[model samples]
Target: MDQVQESYDEFNLNFRIEDTVIVNQTEMEGFNAFFLGNQSTCQQSVVEGVRVLSYKIPATLPLGQFLKKQLYKGEFLSILSNILNQLLYFEDRNMPIKKVLLNTKYMYIELSNLHVQLIYMPIEKEFTDCNVCEFVQNFISKIRFADMQCVNCVDQILHYLDSRLMFSLREFYTFIIELQKEDILKDDIDLGEGETTVLQQMSYNNITPYLVRSRTNALIPIEKTEFLVGKSSECDYQIPDNRKVSRKHCSFRISNGECYIRDENSTNHTYVNGKMIQPGFDVMLKNDDYIRMGDEEFKYWVR
Candidate 1:
C-alpha cells in the first residue's frame, strides 16, 4: 500500500470511533430483523395484537452485527467507496455539516394537496458501533426530509451545485463545505458574544460577514479563502519584509496558521498593534490584534 493508504489504514484502525448514538425501538427492531435474518425470535403483545420476534439481543452482541441489520448493504457499499476515494484523491479538509431543513409550512401543504403522503424519520446516530458511523452521521445530519416531497430539497441542492459550475457535484459540494468552516487560526474569530478574537487581518475589501479585516491588503478575497482554506497550499499573501514583527507573521509560517493583511508595497500600509509596518516587513499577531489603515481601526479575535 502507498504511504497515504497506510496512514489512513492506521487512522481507521486506531483513531476514529465508528459508532454513533441510536435510540428508539422501531428502528432497533427493524435493524435486528434485517441483519439477524429473523432467525432468533422474540415475542411482544399489545392491547389489540401479539407479535413474536427475536429474544432480547445479548448485551454482548457486536455493534457491527446490530448495525448491519439496520443499515442497508447499499449504504455500506457507498460509504466504503467514498472513503477509499477521498483517501486516494483528496486532501481531507475540516468541515461542518451541510444541512438542509425542509420547509414544513408551504411545502407540506403542497404535498398534501397533491395527495402525496410523506413519512420520514430524520437520520439519527445508531447506538451500536460500525465502521461507517461517522459517515452515516455526516450524511444524515446534512439531510432533512420533511412532510413535503423529497424532490424539492434535492432540486435545490442540485441547482446550487450547478450554479457553481461544479464539475463533479459530490466532490465540489464536499470541498466547498469543508472550506467554509470558521478557522480557529484565523486573525478574526468571532465567538458571537461581546468579545472578539483576531487571529489575523484580511484586507479591507475582503471583509466577510463572519470575519472583519481590511480588504485593500488582502492578497485574496474572502470568497476564495472561504473555499480554499484547508484544501490548497498556494499562498495568496507574501511577506515583503524579512523582519518578523509580533506573533502575526510567525503564525503564517506554521502549519494550519493563516492571516490576511494589506501589503505595504501597495498604496496603503497595514498597521498592527499600533505599529505602522513598512513594505516587506512581517508581523506576528495574536488574538485581539489591533490593526489600523487610514481612519479605520479594527480588532481581531478567535470565535
Candidate 2:
C-alpha cells in the first residue's frame, strides 16, 4: 500500500501536457521556412553562414486577455513545446550560440497570469567556468539534494570560493529556498521556541555540544576539535580562564580533531587562536589551539 501511495504521488507530479504547437517545413529562399496558418511569418535565415531563425507572433488583441483564454485549453504547454522544438532544431545544426533571446513582450500582453524568465547561454567563466547550458543540463542529469554526501542542490549553481567572496547569508539562503525547500542554516530553524534546549539536558561528560570562550557560544559538532584561549575584555593585558563554559548551559567537546565554540554574545570577545570573534561568530576549534575570551584563557588539549 505504501508503494502504491508513493506511485500515485509521483504520477501527480509528472502531469502530462496535452496541447502543443505543430511544426511544419516549407520551401524558402534561405535556410528554413514555416508558418502557423496565415497568422505569422516564420523564417530561418543565415547571416554570414550562421543560421538564425526570426519569427513573429501577432498581438492584435491584448496579450493578457488572450493568454487568459488560452490557459483554459492548456495552451501554455503547447507554446513551450514549440519553443523547445525550435531549440532542438538549432542544436541539431552543431552550431553553438552564446545566448538565445525569446521576445516575450507580446507574452506579457495576453499572459498576465504567467511569467517568463530569460536564461542566457555560455555562463561567465569567472563563476565556476560552467556555461548556463551546462548548468541546466547538470540539473536535469545527475543532481541530488538532501544528503550529507551531496554538498549542493542541482537546481542551483555551486560556486565555492573562499570566505572572502561569501556574500550575505540572507541573500544566499533566499536563493536556496527557491531551488530547494530546505535551508538548514536559517536562523528560525527550530520548530518551536523553548526556554531550554536538548543540549542543556545532555551531560557535559557524555556529550558537550557547545563551547564557550569569553562568553561567545560556539557549537561543537561531534568528532570535531578546536582550540581554547583567553584575553581581557576591559584590557588586552588581562587574561581569562583557559576553559570556560558559556552561560552554564552548554560546554564544548571535541570528538575528532576540530575545535568549536558557541556565541552567547557575551560582553567580552572570544578570540579563537588569534582571531577575535564577535558575539555570533562560531569559532573554529582546533587541537592545541589558543583561545582567549574576556578574562578567561585556555590552551585546548586533544583527548
Candidate 3:
C-alpha cells in the first residue's frame, strides 16, 4: 500500500467540460465493467423518470446508517474484514484506490451478515477527497464495544494513528488483524494457535500479581488486566529517560493466575531470564522471572 500513491498528471485536461459535451455513458456504469446488472458486492441501477445514473446496492443499508448505532463486536469485525479484503483486492488488481469511495455513506452493508460493499469509479481520476485514516477514525468513533479487550484495542489503534506521521493501509490491516486475533484468543491466552477456548473460570481471588524493580526494590502492583510498561508517560509503569525503550514498550496481560508478557516491538527488545523474547508473542511469566525492558530490569512476583 505504501508503494502506491496518487501523482498529478500535468499534461491532462485542465479546462472544464460543458454539460452538452459528449461523455462516455459507460463511465457512469459502476465497478465490474458490465451494465447495471445486480451481482455480488455492488449493484447498479437507474430509477424510473430519473436522468442521473446511480449505484444501488439492494437489500442493504448504508454503513453510516448501519453504524452510528449500537453494534456487536462480531459485526464490527465482519465489516472490517470485508472492507479490507476488498481494498487488498483492489491493490492486487492495480486499481486506483483513490477512485474507491471511503466514505461510510457510499459504503453499503447488511446488518444480519455484516456484509460490506464499496463504490468505486472506473474513471481516470480520484473521486473521494478523504483518506483511509480519516474514514477509519470516524468509523471507529461510532463503534461501542462491551469488552475490555476491544476497548484496549481501540485505544491502541487510536494511539498508533496519532503517533505516526504517515499511515499505511496494509500496515493498518495487519494491526487490525492482530487485534482481531488477540480478541478471539483472549480467553485462551495459554492455548496455541487454532486451539479452542475452554471457557473455565479460574479462581485467583486469593492471589495477586505484582512487579518489583530489581535494582531499587520498588514494588508496583499489577492493578489492571492489561498493564503497560514503556518510556511514555501514558504507560502504567513508565521507564523514564530511556532512549532504547519505545514509547509503548512491553505489555503485561494477567490471565487465570498467570502473567503473560509481550514484547511490543521495542528497539532494544524485551527479555525473560536473559533470553530475548519474540516481539508481539506473549510469554507466560513464572515466579521471580527476570524480565528486562531495554536497560531497565524487573522481577515478576505473583503469589
Sort order, TM-score high to low: 3, 2, 1
lDDT of 2 by residue, 34-100 (tens): 3221122334444445443333333233223333331311233233333344444334443232233
Number of backbone clashes in candidate 1: 43
Candidate 3: stretches off by over 4 Å: 1-30, 33-52, 125-128, 187-303
* Model 2 lDDT, residue 134, Cα: 36
Displacement of the residue 295 alpha carbon in candidate 3, Å: 49
Backbone clash numbers for all candidates listed: 43, 40, 0
| Candidate 1 lDDT by residue in tens digits, 155-221 | 4334433343112324433532332222223325556767766433221121221124454433332
Q: Provide the TM-score for each candidate, comma-separated.
A: 0.20, 0.21, 0.47
lDDT of each: 0.30, 0.33, 0.64
State the weakest 10-residue window (summed lDDT) of model 2.
8-17
Error of 3 at 114 (Å): 1.1
The TM-score of predicted model 1 comes to 0.20
Score residue 154 of candidate 1 by CA lDDT.
38
True-vs-predicted CA distance for residue 4, candidate 2, Å: 47
